[model samples]
Target: MKIIAAGLLLMNVAFGQTQLRSLRAVPVPEPSGLSEYVRDKASLIRLGKVFFWDMQAGSDGVTACATCHFHAGADHRPQNSLVDPNSPFRVNAELSTVLFPLYLLSDPRNRNSAMVRDSGVRVGSAGTFRRIFEGIVPGQAAELGRDALDKPEFMRGDMQVRRVTPRNTPSVFNTVYYVRNFWDGRAGRTFDGFTVTGANEAEGPGVLVARNGGLERQRVRIDKASLAAQAVGPALDHLEMSYAGRTWPMLAKKLLSLPPLALQKVAIDDSVLGPLARKEGRGLEEQHTYFAMIQSAFEPKFWESSERLNAAGELDPMGEFTQVGHNFSLFWGLALQAYQSTLNSDASPFDRFMEGDSHALTPQEQEGMRLFQNAAGCTRCHNGAEFSAAAFNENGSTRADSFERTGVRPVGDDIGSGNGAFKSIGLRNVEFTGPYFHNGGQSTLEQVVDFYRRGGDFAPITGDLRAFAATPGQTAAIVAFLKALSDDRVRYERAPFDHPELCVPVGHEEDESGELKPGDVATSAAERWRGLAAVGAGGNAAPLQTFDEMLRKFGENGERAHTMNEACTASLASLLGR
Candidate 1:
């Protein structure tokens, strides 16, 4: 019976039914138990909320789970500018749009293609990026310096450092329902019947190993329990929070051991530590006080043993205790997972527009949606309620053991999309998450569309996939639909972070340049074209060529096929050129 079904699919393709095949809408589970911690118990959510923003969870007090998996609720960073450039990053632009390099340069690959040159020069996509890090003035130094590289609240005993994380952070907003975590589903695995399947799948180290540009094939079932369990990866990942050295248990104990006398005398009203510090003085001491306040803010009554503790003489007048309860760590995971479960955005206007709400979307948006679902073939992978398929495949027909290459395969020991390929990210709340793509290769929504329309990755240095091309205007409609996915209401905002007491001369100064510098030459037309080719050559060139050929197969204009050059995205060029 399975063989017969496969045969029919082939016959359908032969009969030109490939384009006519109807997409099946997979059912997404409703938000359940997610509200168990947040719906009515705002206090529990309140605790979770504070923890989400608390950078002290990491060893250095500089990083947080949120640092990479930012609440902007989308993929993190574009063009890998957020990290030290000596450590590079790359991605397939079509699968993502919001993470493009807004102020960084495309990585240069040295293959010969229609779009790139083998100059062996590594240039940033954003001219000002390097300058931002190196700093031209004092204020610039303060803004970009990595002085307080670790979290101020974390105990030094909790510090741990490892290799850079293998993949970009996925948004946590609507992750409650997801079974697997990480781009390659490397978390959530269980030891046996004791663990959830999804948890088991995501439990290993963050890196993915591909066999012949494919993942190891296997069947796995996922559930919300697994999603909740998988949420702990960052807290333990050395490159992320690196809390493994100072497990939540250790962190809790350390924070509990601090002398209340010092904490109390630290004065909620000291010049540098006062609650009103934000209004009056602005100094390093004030920031340190703020971090202390955040740690001390959790009401003592809710956490203390009250009457029992008083009888035993174990409680303080301020109702504080000397030790944190074991439940605190368990509660941390519970609250986080529960809150993430509610991150569903299925009720978007675009969803309604597709469900027969003719007025839900503007005509332009409606046309764009149509293009996304049908003409552009984007629905092949980004097809469900969350706007992506968890199932891995090679193209639409071939079953493969590895994750999708998106044709960004690198050349000559470059090790492009081998062990480094990421999972397909869901398209939700895309507008606020600038610098799109897994490795953040592209910088804008239109640029992402242009990438897909042209095909997948291009080799920037080697010019490996320079022959790939896309139809003009085909990507514009797709870009329109992606823009509609933005949810401004949920966009995360950064609260003031100050830790003056942590001002102990700060950590080691980084020698490498950072993103958003001021003196670099701006990306030009020629540079962008070379960038496109560079991206293709760096990844799976086969699909890049195949997809571009498919675009031409649909009769898109060939003469207008000038590749992106400099940093001017097609959409930007359209407006700037005019």
Candidate 2:
């Protein structure tokens, strides 16, 4: 009878739906030893939010981690967003309506006939212009630099445009559940607090935590802190945030001199920072120094030490550095992780339905849920509450399940999962994260569904994808079901998702002024800024646009996806020949 019951439960799981709230998130492991690094969790979270949104943190003083993540935890700007893999500059193509469905078949029903269009242009976030580092201009959130002739492809006429990241950024929402982060899982589960990779991969002595009346180089492996590990990479990455040769110490020294959010305004009703907010106008009223925030949020051992260190982080014979200045990266990574962990969005319509609110979902959405689990078999890989097999509770013992090859791209040597493996990102707010896939090839959820429904666009198949036919109504219902996972809080920038004003570089224009700026390299691309107004805990009234909505000219092109198949590879092999 017990065996029969077990079999029955398995059957139910196979066909029945599972609620997102049922599964446990990957535990956010604190840094080892030192008891706890945080003296005040609330203060620490506030610090994290400030760091994550502080544009001054960038070498140019105009970018932030929030720049790429401003829209529902993913980028949706249509201009200068497409990446052509063959381009030496890495990206130059602009996104447009006709260029989508990246690998479209002439016939939606047929796997092979003749290719109608394959733009080879994909989506990506635009970052800073490539320039050799000089040094920070004293007392400013900017750098002094001379330009070098970077890749000629990056050059447009006499000016150079901003560079684009190679991969499509995954949403940061509900990322606390992932065992590993990033498309290739380069951001490991154990944060080292120093290296770009995980602690296990760190080469040097690791994070410098003060000990025994003096500073010490100790290797601290904070478990379940992939978010921390992930947070450390982009800060110094010349392509992403910093100038070439920018060091954490340099960044720290610059920030320590400035008050919290000295470059931007803080909302009076900010979810986390409101208590520290100014009574009127911009910035905090108290002039909370980064040093003070660190001192309050972290233990005395972290910031109380007066150890003088050089740019290399070595104890200098003659130098002026505080423990806070030397170990800023560690604080930055962990605090950012703390803030991101709070960005959970488990309150969507589907979540409400799972919580016993039957009317939360429409009748068709309910049927779509049935099809997603039973017919579509989406639950097999996208199991658990997070709708991701990559969630730690679902695949703790295996790294392979952390990735899958829907065959979005071709196999290549040493290329990150170049055989098309990518992170099985959670689909909580799929409506807003546009230009789907690691390649950022597909433009809308409908386009994504169509890619999956007819079979993924690539070949040499072997994975969780295969062609299966669905009626138009069934397809629409599945899309509707996916949309039901979106949380209104995320959509409206409420509470944990609310952020400070950030000026993001959306595109480039001619340097019409023809005047050299402090960081200008050979008349670097005159940037165009898209200013985001700060939101508070109360959230915004305007609804964020879906990727489909953002791509206004795409029409109804968002209405397609490949069907999920448990065993259809042998049939698709010839159809999608390598």
Candidate 3:
């Protein structure tokens, strides 16, 4: 019955930076002079949340930004999460516990020993069908898209399933602190208000802004707004959400005409959208268009011009849009970042303990913290208030990008950040964001620990990883400490973390031979999906499940080591800590 007290500790983080135990003390890097562009911050956040969850935002009318980022700001679905990385999204298959640690060795300690498994199939989120963008169908959520002519990889006979992303999806919660977003640091430190790769785009014409009665190519350069930069990317990617040839103006045109969160139900008590929610059914009470939300959030110069911009999408050659519709990218990106900025999970048990609550963490968990800081060498990358070297405010030096070549895979495979260096991601809410790493090869936090214990899978250019001997007790303690990082608010979808309802596609009815399970789209139902019910600011009845819990439920019938039946999820949730 030994009691442990967590005293406040200050330590030097990576690259000559200092960080305190209490994360709230760290100031997130925000773009100043925002008042010139933003009209109302609250309205901007509301617009962001609604846009993130609205199915109408997707060209297919189903795949919203929240589809890949619902659970704790990251995807947790196991079915159709894997893709062939070597071939670069050649297949989208169900990932299982049996096939993991993609590149494995027979001897854990030996790197040159006989290989057990080397799978090219990496874990990622499933996205849109293979289709070409035609035009905004005016009042329709779906763009007037035609099926692609090419023989697509993600297919069951003639039926087109969803394509998977080559990279694993990261959480959007703490991204406001990142100097650059994505595994590849393509989402640059500065946002030009147009594209994610705006920094490296050779000083091209920047984001288009509406002036008196004409379009002006605004040379916008807002620093520390990488979240805004990253926010605009997936919305137009052919595999992620849009059809081929869909442009910003076209997508914007569609969204401006539609009602906010039209296809989804908003909780009446929602922190941001509650007052706007309808009294009895789906959508908001005002029945206002997304354009109205934009008007409420952004400055008049960005949207109030009388100019009409021609649609740039190939299929929508005849389509013309208003000034507000044309600059949708800038509005969407900034607003989403504004909403995500409030999503920082600084209320974990570890945070409370650091802020002077001794009983916040168990003694074993405190011991785990010590090992994590010292013996485990976790702080070399996972350091600072944000728990990531990639955090802009973490390091005094220019290492906030924190792109390290840890040799998880060969440099020739992906060439991330130029030389196989991936961004060192933050570790907050890690308990809920499993399937770890950029490839998402690990299933649980324990497996992630095991990966580090063995000095990583590939080692041609290992960063700071080296073999370490840790006992079972030490490992358990470390894992418990990791779990302590889970913020109660995020786990229950409370306050700023709450959102509208969403229906994410799980998988299609298909066999191993890539054949459909008979019937039409309704019967065979490749579009088989699951609903994530709306949670208000008051929070849900139970906390969200860890990745493994949902993974096992989605696993093959009776193949999961734990579950007797998949339907037992809700009943067993009580025993499983929600």
Query: Which candidate wins on TM-score?
Result: 3
lDDT winner between 2 and 3, please give it.
Answer: 3
Write down the TM-score of every candidate. 0.50, 0.87, 0.88
Candidate 2: RMSD over Cα atoms? 9.7
Q: Which ten residues in a row have the lowest lDDT in candidate 1?
A: 497-506
Task: Name the regions of candidate 1 deviating beyond 4 angstroms.
Answer: 1-44, 74-113, 117-166, 189-223, 255-329, 391-403, 409-421, 458-471, 491-578
Task: Please provide the root mean square deviation of candidate 3 (C-alpha atoms, Å).
Answer: 5.9
Tens-place lDDT per residue, model 1, 417-521, is: 344444455676665454455544444576566555545553332212122233455455567677666543342121111111111101111224422221112
Deviation from native of the Cα of residue 22 in model 1, angstroms: 17
**How big is the positional error of residue 545 in model 1, measured in Å on the Cα after superposition?**
34
Question: Residue 461 of candidate 1: its Cα lDDT?
Answer: 26
Alpha-carbon deviation at 80 in model 1, angstroms: 9.2
On lDDT, the candidate that comes out on top is: 3
Residue 176's lDDT in candidate 1: 40
lDDT of 3: 0.74
